[model samples]
Target: MEFYAGSRDACYEAKSAGLPKASGGCLLANASLREGQLLVGGHPFVIGKKDSGNRSSRDYYSHKLAWVSEKFVVLWDEKDKRGWLVNGASALLHIVMTSLEQLSPAFKSICLFDPASIQEGKHPHQPDSATEVLLNINNRQLRIYREDDGPPRFQGQVEICYNMLEKMIEYQLIVLERVRNSRIIVPRAHLEGWDFRHLAQRFDPIYPRLAVLDTNGKSWVDFTRSIHAVTLFGRGFGEIIRPTGACSAWATLPCGKYYLAACAADLQKIMDGHGGQYSTPLRLTDDDIWYIPDKSTGQCLCKDKTDATHSDLAQILLPSDMCKNLSLNPSGCYQTDRGAFIFGFNEIHQWFWNDTGNPFRKMAGESSDLLLNPGISYMSDSSVFRESLGIEEVRDASYLRLVPQQMSSDNYTVGIICALTIELKAVGALFDSTHAYVPSPDHDPNDYVFGSICGHNVVASCLPDGDYGTTSAALAAGHMCRSFNGVEFYLLVGVGGGAPHTNKQDIRLGDVVVSTPKGSKTGGIPYDTVKTLQGGVHIINGYLSPPPYRLRSVLRLLLKSDPNPPKAPLQPYLDQIAQSVDGCGYPGQENDQLFDSDYSHLAEAETCDSCDPQKCIQRTLRPSTQPRIHYGLIASGNQVMKDSKTRDRLGEEQDILCFEMEAAGIMNTVPALVIRGICDYSDSHKNKGWQKYAAATAAAFMKLLLSNVPVSNDRGQRQQAPMFSG
Candidate 1:
């Protein structure tokens, strides 16, 4: 730039300009194409027209000009295909028009720039220092984000990613989402180099605002092949930014070190392709914490890390020695007084302990420090991070997982609890990205899986195999509440018997039933526990709690979407489940046989094949196979209703539209809404054939419902990375 800055050809400089909007939306074309103008960094710039001498001068009107240190401006001349970058200094270096278009493709596609959109990005440590700049590109998006390199910088050069200005013209890359970590700060008294000062123009907490790319779209997956998709927090579960498939590989830090981390399944495949000879004899190819030993000597070897690997197995990783004082924390790593290190698996925090003993390994000294402890976390089953980081969990439940802490459990906001493997399958199939298992507390026996969908992080759990009924669901829900924090609400999703014999709903097999209050009774009614004296069931202490306002509000919007909302919105999701999980497809209505309430499924019949069709109840044919969603009171109990008479009697008594085994118990444990896909009429005719499709319908509805639910209660705000260098 210094070379070009000296040439000083017929380049342009701005003294002042005017706009009706009086904001920054101007493209510096020749007079013809220009229509409107905007202020840049809160000041208007004018391109002085040439006199007979071909020179330009400042034309100061009533508007005051900003200082040299106050603004950074871009003057785009679309007519001449030229643009300039000015730092409020007199010298204006022209930016090659090709570079700008390389990332955005067409200049015509740019939106009107608003001064409000330009944010002041400062160093996290030195808050007022403005030495680094970032250019973020999304699908059809060109935006800028700022990051202060903090303590990670080498000398004065920024450590945060900043190669965009250098490479945009030749090789353009698309960033998944804009970079942001906006937690407020108080400068650390002891830390030496990081004394942050508030800017002259303070920051808006919602910096780097962007429209997240559609999770179902393939554009990002294809784009990831060439460059990394850097999601700042809760990567896998948060849908933060996924480097997915075989192309999902990158150095997972901003310091520019090539520290390649991969899932257990992907480790070998990545190493095989990028293998290089190391300076040491050991190849070091596998991706797990291990120690190599001499075959003859049979002694522990290469012991320098993982102090609490046994008792702390997958919980935390403290640098081998822990009986010491501490230094600073970077990202999540801490150095102790003894020079041993303990790093958080991520950029946030977690607690640690002293021991885990195994017969195969030697004992290390007791970890003594109660100081700030860093730990490991996963966003999936066998794991759920403590919800204290930014991750919007969910994806197509694909297998691309993250081991490193891109998402903590706090990253997960919605909890889905299922009771069977088929039900779990349906829920898992809908995850935006399936997170690697993060071990949970021993008391939480429920297996958890984490993901992000629609704008919320989702954590799912299943009751142990062969477990059914209220008690089992209660235990699972209790465990989830204990381990997976930050969940705003829970959805008990799975299959249940449809009590369509009642006049309220024509719920057929595979239709979805959402629990909504009816009359004076609430949504989920524990009919089995209710007092049934005087031939009418007495309220079982108000039956159940009303659905949470967040859920109720979303439901109202869903119902009001249309008098007859087409199945179009949910088709894509249903098709996804059908394709991923076999038998989840609509199991033709021909197999949907509803027998007379008095007629029992023949004791010898496996399906309805041998049963008398003449005795079957005739019902109106549905217009299509699309699952209809019905919202009303649901009858919940401890026992499965295999008798149709009991089911109808309960429905009529309780004003129920559906019958399920788990909801009563779950509602008692965790305040939630019960959604059941009608697998069969609660009768002897109930079979496993409709379970999968039924579960799919319920899960699809859950996804659709969430699509309308806002990421409530600041849950979407990611926890900021540590700005202090300890």
Candidate 2:
């Protein structure tokens, strides 16, 4: 084969010699080419060089400056031959040669192709009408057309397209070498006559252009933007991208059966030998559709049953035989002896499946995954699904991605338990803002109100209106612990009866009493005592668990910082609540009254107005309005303390500072600090007037203590608790 560059006469001579003309103004001798020979130009050829005028020359220069070349290749084919023409090969070669000449002398003798050797088919070459050549170069595959077979002419000359052909050969060689050394294990069945060229063509256009086909082979344009498929092999899974760029996974279980999994977990179980079979075997059902949840968006794959045409959002339909062969629950969820196997539905109900037999369907054009229609009560919310599946609830993506490490105990969670709605509201007012409520499966009818206070996540719970006392408190605390897993400590804050004594501490109305350990026992003790006459005296032994050491340390700090605790700054919160017509407001400090234990008078009276002034114990001076905070033991029992003599006796024996009905129960479930605002003196004068102010004071003190506490970190080492002197 002879290759020429420069004049058009050279091409005419080649034609006279009966040689085929190739693109880029070159000719090839058909006879010599059949023997596998290579030919290349010795120098460059300058085409379109016309001497028009000075202005034309400037215009040509401008054109060159503006020219932005594109990547393209030409495809041509004959009766039995086909090849590709690499666009811009000539220009690229010229640039490469110029650069090489300046780099080293060795490049001077390096010829791209030999001109003397006129042998045919000697070097590896791009085959005509071959798919391998096109794939190797990452070019879009196209049908090979011949001159007689189509309107466009076809030509094949090895010498003219030498530069592009050489590059294609180099790329193919590199690919072949990598495959030879690759560690990818292809099964023996797949290895039989495995032609990569054919595979490339088959999977060409891996990404869909305009539309994709559903399981039923029906095309739809508004498909899920990016559906992915992964294959599970052994213990791991791999992603498979089709030529049309649709992603899906395939898994072959140890049972020697292949199945399509909705997500990684379904296939992962089989890999782990954990009976991780698909809810229903793929073979048992026809038109069996599965949806995977997108963890990021909290959305699931759902099918629009109302649409006549098959859509991505429409229910997946499996073969009727497959459905009949498998045993599925009414919801179409797979049920095993262990439990139901619902894929993405395990986490927030991101996906919904419609059983073919179900008569009800979603209304047309409603795209949301949430089942809003009435009568559809079985659909799982994200929390319920995760709980039933024994998986953790899917949290916000930001929290998941940013905090990869497990939550630390240092990340303090403060749980506030209130026995009344007023108490709950008072505590909630201390926080800056409330968090959006996301229902949890473990939480009961009265869900926790979540907020943030002083950088700590505060979860507040209130007992049902009719329920109060230790038993109810224990149940509420238990629910809080289960639902809010990371809660480090709890604060039982509400109103309590003060145990004022003539000696020791002067506990008064509206005073805050905080639970502190006495010796080894907790400050809050259950006084559900049974008086037994042993020999000559009655013995009273109470039940108690020591408060957490960290809480004790915090109490010590709070006392050491202040000699006389000042009234809590809680008026703002009280005022905010008072604005609401249903809210409780301050009952006034004048209403606070302290009566002698010996004095008993008023009966069935709403206020002291009916009582005789002389009967009431007279005082020379009135006590200050500032509420004092006291730290000592608190007695907790099922019954509300009313008699002052009984309160004094218990206070003297146990050195208790206050009495409340809930703390003892919470101690049974969680190590907590009991903060109670003194509403009454545990006397006949007890009334509901002081309950609101007492709750406010306790909540205010809680806020102050929490504000001073350092945020917990992962180190787990205890830090110095904050101290408040007053």
Candidate 3:
């Protein structure tokens, strides 16, 4: 682990040259990286590699860079085996890391680095002492085995425990895309200081289990046979298990008998307690299943379903409220009282807090842990099964990576971007069926959730939680295009502010606004810049590219086909969503008032409850509360339009029907259409009461829009939208 002195000059800003030939298309002159180690943001990186095999090693690791602007140079720390991402795409030489660390334990390593603070010395060796010396796990202390006068108990409990382990492994493999498999076993373990810390703090209380990750940094397997397992975080890592010196050939396989397994010491204790009587092992049925009584709470109770021998699992597993539903039964199994909303599914995972750690780790010391080994950890895209870890170690070309053509990102023909989590949820509700999670390349930052609508495959994404504004939206759309290049068109669908540019427009809360080309302006957001002149202040408007010809044409066909129809085409979908999910219905006309242009909301209030009702502009009520769809230009900017004066001026001057933060940033990046559900008036009176309903309206319309889009490879103009049935 030695290297020659690399270039001392902070990374050479190679403008137009030195990009790897493999990345020809992404070779934007604004950004470039070379093949060797370069000091970036005072750290180091081995960038732009050609040979994937030579890219990373057991000691060092590499991950795909979703974005690499000259301003934000991501660097790899070979010493710590992690990659560091700088904050903001435009922060050149300003190495301010995002607060991803604060968000979750998974990302606690991401922090503001002061190059001067790094002590250039080895970590002070911790001398092994009485406090540091940990012991081999004693299975007896796990408290998993207990006895009664009847028969040897806990066979059913052990099966549940084994199933719980499998459930944990399955999520890591499919959803988290971290574990290679779940059969990693070791005859012995040498727990160290780090292992002792994680076991006591994270695993011992509730997340009880011993999971092992490969040193090659590939995948992980949980060996929670009976809680005698060690907690090994990927970092601070000391190898616990391996082929010990010689060839230690062992086949780790799943066994059902592991549930009722007993040692000689346990048998003697049982015999002494029961007056020299030999106890028979109880046979459990329904290997690994959880009977969930409340799907909403996601709380469950388990039953062995064999002879009535299983203990009351609900008392141990169910939440406090669930205690009411679970009833005492003669079979020893906790049963949900008759006619309860119970379903059966087997998945038991520790509740996750974030990239950092869970709620349990919050009160503890600031200790970091990589839940999965990077070697086998799939990219952020939850393509957990991206690679197959052979039963034996990889010696040659034995493992084959299978990526189905249908599941490829290229097959996802449409892209949907939501600025908020609520918007994401609204749009996701309309998906006919979600596609399987696929692994993404290292460079792509977006973790796409794929779904289908009327045979159209859509890759949906939302701005990272708590992030908004045009720049973030643009960065997200840029990554979306690069990750899912085959996405023909994108929809920037979410909630926005209503302007009601003209009296005839009749816009209100829970109404849908679509960007439609008017004269020289292709429908999109107009960002107006204030330009001061000698006589008067003039506005210099920045325009963006319109939606693609294909989408605009389809919109026209859709409108024409259902011109003056009996009702709104998206009503059915909106109703379905409202019925399925709570609080996504129309907020009622009383909650949908528009304040006068000069009026302002009462300060420091969450809602308009404190404001004078007289300030609300009186308008003729529509025959029905169904939202009217308006097609016009929208004003987009980085700032929220909360000032009533500015909202009116911009609406009148720019002829804008709606205002939003993200559309302007995305319009230039992709062939995108901006569909906004008017939640607020872009005024001080804006409240969240209408946001969910507004989001629903926008999503409903987008569903209607996509329903009219024929899935066949026809980028040309679409005919009448016969699919629209109001």
Compare the candidates by TM-score and give the number of the best one.
Answer: 1
Residue-wise lDDT of candidate 1 within 428-524, one digit each (tens)?
6665444446567877766666555544567887776677888888888888887878777899999989888676668799888999876786788
Output the lDDT of residue 436, model 2. Answer: 38
lDDT of 3 by residue, 567-676 (tens): 54566567545643468988789777787878777789898887888887888888988898988888888888888888777777677888889988899888999999
Top of the candidates by lDDT: 3
Could you tell me every candidate's TM-score relative to the true structure?
0.47, 0.42, 0.45
Q: Candidate 1 or 2, higher TM-score?
A: 1
Per-residue error at 41 for model 1, in Å?
A: 32
Off by over 4 Å in 1: 1-405, 532-542, 561-564, 712-726
User: Which model is ahead, 2 or 3, in terms of TM-score?
Assistant: 3
Worst 10 residues of 1 by lDDT: 189-198
* lDDT agreement of model 1 with the native: 0.44
Q: Sort by lDDT, best first: what order? A: 3, 1, 2
lDDT of each: 0.44, 0.42, 0.45
Q: What is the C-alpha RMSD of each candidate to the true structure, in Å?
A: 19.1, 29.2, 28.5
Model 2 CA deviation exceeding 4 Å by range:
1-412, 442-446, 519-521, 562-586, 619-623, 713-726
lDDT of candidate model 3 versus the reference: 0.45
